[model samples]
Target chain A: MRTLLASLLILIVIPATIALGIVVLDDRNYYFISLLIILYTMIPFAMVFESRKPQARELIIIAVLTAIAVAGRSAFFMLPQFKPVLAIVIIAGVSMGAEAGFLVGAMAGFVSNFFFGQGPWTPWQMFSFGIIGFLAGILFKKGWLKRSKALLCVFGGLSAILIYGGLMNLSSVTLFASTFNKEALLAAYASGIWFDLVHAAATVIFLFLLSRPMLEKLDRIKTKYGLIER
Target chain B: MGRDSFSTYHPAVNFLYFAAVLGFSMFFMHPVLQGIALFSAAVYSVTLSGGKAVKFNVIYMLPALFILAAVNPLFNHAGMTILFYLKNGNPVTLESIVYGIAAAAMLVTVMIWFSCYNKVMTSDKFIHLFGKIVPALSLIFSMVLRFVPRFRHQIQAVSLAQRSIGRDVTQGNVVHRARHGLRILSIMATWAMENAIETADSMKARGYGLPGRTSFAIYRFDRRDRTVLVLMIVLIAIVLAGAGMGENTMRYFPSMRMKEQTLFSGVVYAAYSLLCMLPVIIQLVEELRWKYIVSRT
Candidate 1:
């Protein structure tokens, strides 16, 4: 009940803060405001997760998964945009739970940036990857998404394209242009389509090969350690 | 890393200083203000990281600036002064060209500032600042930071072991190599999971998650930190007052207009310059003091 109330409060407060930011702040400040909104959205999840008083084992498992997702990026340096991060994140969501999924995804995004370099795109990347993990968990929990390989691939590909690619391109447009216009948005999307396609293809391919073993490993870990049970 | 006096302050002080400068750089689009921001950011970045920063600014940021500035007028045609028309019947306006340059400068300036931020605000400092608010998440963050390097080393060892068994990533076609890599990753995951039990047990033995836990940190809010904090707040307040009075922003869409230069505006500009150059100034003063003490000794 407290978690639900917190979620309700977040749902109301975040949009109101964004709307206030857009109304009160200057147009040139859109990038900062949007980044703030992304930061704000992640806070409630963290708050809810913390309030639950999670055990040390639960935190360790999430940390290990997030570290794998980040370290896994280096293994695919030969293939640009072909990373196992989303695959690991999706597997984390499917096997662990939504909150763990969000934590893993967000921390992976942030830690990876520490190795690469933190830029204006850091918050957007974190938000995009986190939301995908979150939605994957929710849909799986609701029985809308299956544990099958084919279905997971489809979902991963679509989410990679629509969620991660879309948000990143929108951020690019926001960062580059002073004023937001339809032409700029269209141009940004047009130029970014090929990159997004490659990324989606990578997600689909990673999920195809990784989902089964990864899920099995996570399940074993849960059974062995008596982790956070659904 | 090049040592700067600013980085020696409290993490809150460092965070506040960067937040103020970055926010000001992003919001204020006046040409003079933008120039001040860009110049100070570059100098401070150089001071923080030395010649490599210069190479980064010239190699990556310069071309990015030109490309962004060139691309903007193509899509954005929102000014009264029509410079020309493109093949797509869009008017290339002077306003858009200028706006593009301004936005690109702002982006580059912010990027440099973040580089400086990444240097000064180490992970421990960030964890310390945010640990209380989000204890579990902060713990996870610190754990991940430690785990990434350990995992990377383990990955290397696993790949080598796999190579000895003739299932190497480098000794195959693309598909085979990818499969080998995935196999190594799978092994790594299994190892990580199995070993993590020990980590959790160790934590449990150490009384983790207990109430009244205290973290050890080297930082303190000393007199120097307080003085610097007060100065930063004063400068930030003056600049924000200028912003409230519309003296820190310029109109650049559909027309070009600027707040008239006045005595108060000059004061605001001075305050902003000081705010942005705070780190560089502090570094310079420290260096001079060190020189004098060395000569006396």
Candidate 2:
């Protein structure tokens, strides 16, 4: 009940805070709203962990998965937008539960950006990747998403890239530009489609090659060490 | 790696300086202010990186600036003053062209500041600042940061081993090369998983995440750090307050209007310049001091 209430509070607080944030923060200081949204997302993530009391072993696996998701970017440097980061993140989510997935996905964006550069986009990256991971985990847990290779690839190929790239395009319009013109937003999204498609194709490739093996390995680790359960 | 003066300060001091300068550069869209911010950041990047700065400016920064400036006038056609008509008969406005240039400057300045950040704030320093407030998080962050480099090194070794067996990425056709690369990656993944388990075991052995398990830190809020901190707060407050008052604000919509230079805005600009230059100045002073002491001998 407490976990449910905390999740409820988290959901309620996000939109409320954002509405309040629009009123409070100026356009110039709008990244502060992004930060607020990031904080809002973290409330649920932290609460889930707090309630579970995750052991040191579980934390380490999550950290390692996040590390792979981060380091996964460098592996695909030769191939533009052929990132295994999202694929690795989704695999982690599918094998582990939602909370671990969120942590790994959020940390992947967070850690990688420290290498790239932090901007207003950082929090958005974190939130999008985190949510994608969270949803994958939840779906896997509820048996809505099968553990089959084809199913995972299909789900990941369709969702993670579009959501992540699409959301980032929306943020580019909101954060960088002065006016929030729908026409401008649409143009931005349209321009971003090629990159988004490239990312989606990459997601499909990585998921095809690595999803089953990675998931099996993660499942083994969870059972062997009594780590995170899906 | 340890060449920069900002590295010597407390993590809090280093982080605060970058945050303030970056925020100021991004939000303050005044043309003159953008130039100042860009120039100051360029100077600092050169100081930190020396001759390599020229190469970076040419290879990365210049192209980015040009692309950004050129791209804006293409789409955004909002202003009283139309600059030119595109081949499609769409009006390209003077305001967008100007806004494009300013945005480019802002982007370049922020990028330069980040390069400076990369120089000064090492992963350890980043972890150090937040380790206390969020122990688990900092641990994971530091670990992940560590893994980026480690994974790179590991891939090198794996590739070398693969090359010896004629399974090298370079030795094959496009399809064969990709297969070899994935083989290496698959190995790396397994290694990463095992390595993480070993790491967890080590931490468990060390009684990490235990109640009252204290940590030793090399960073402290020293006297110099205190002064830097105070300066950071004061300068940021003045700049933010000035921005809030619309002192340095530049509007580019129906028309372009530069903010009139009030006394308060002047002070804010001076404070900002000093704030941005503080790292460069500290580095300069240290260099001069070293030379003087050597000359005395």
Cand. 2 TM to true fold = 0.86
Error of 1 at A13 (Å): 5.2
Docking class of 2: acceptable
Candidate 1: clashing pairs of residues: none
Q: After superposition, how far is residue B49 of candidate 2 from its true place, in Å?
A: 0.8
For every model shown, what is its TM-score relative to the native structure?
0.94, 0.86
Instruction: Kindly list the per-residue Cα lDDT of model 2 for residues B23-73, writing each as its tens digit.
Output: 678667777667778988999988888889878977999998988788777
C-alpha local distance difference test of each model: 0.87, 0.79
Q: Which residue segments of model 1 deviate by more than 4 Å?
A: A1-26, B162-180, B295-297
DockQ, computed on Cα atoms, for candidate 1: 0.78
Model 1 — TM-score against the truth? 0.94
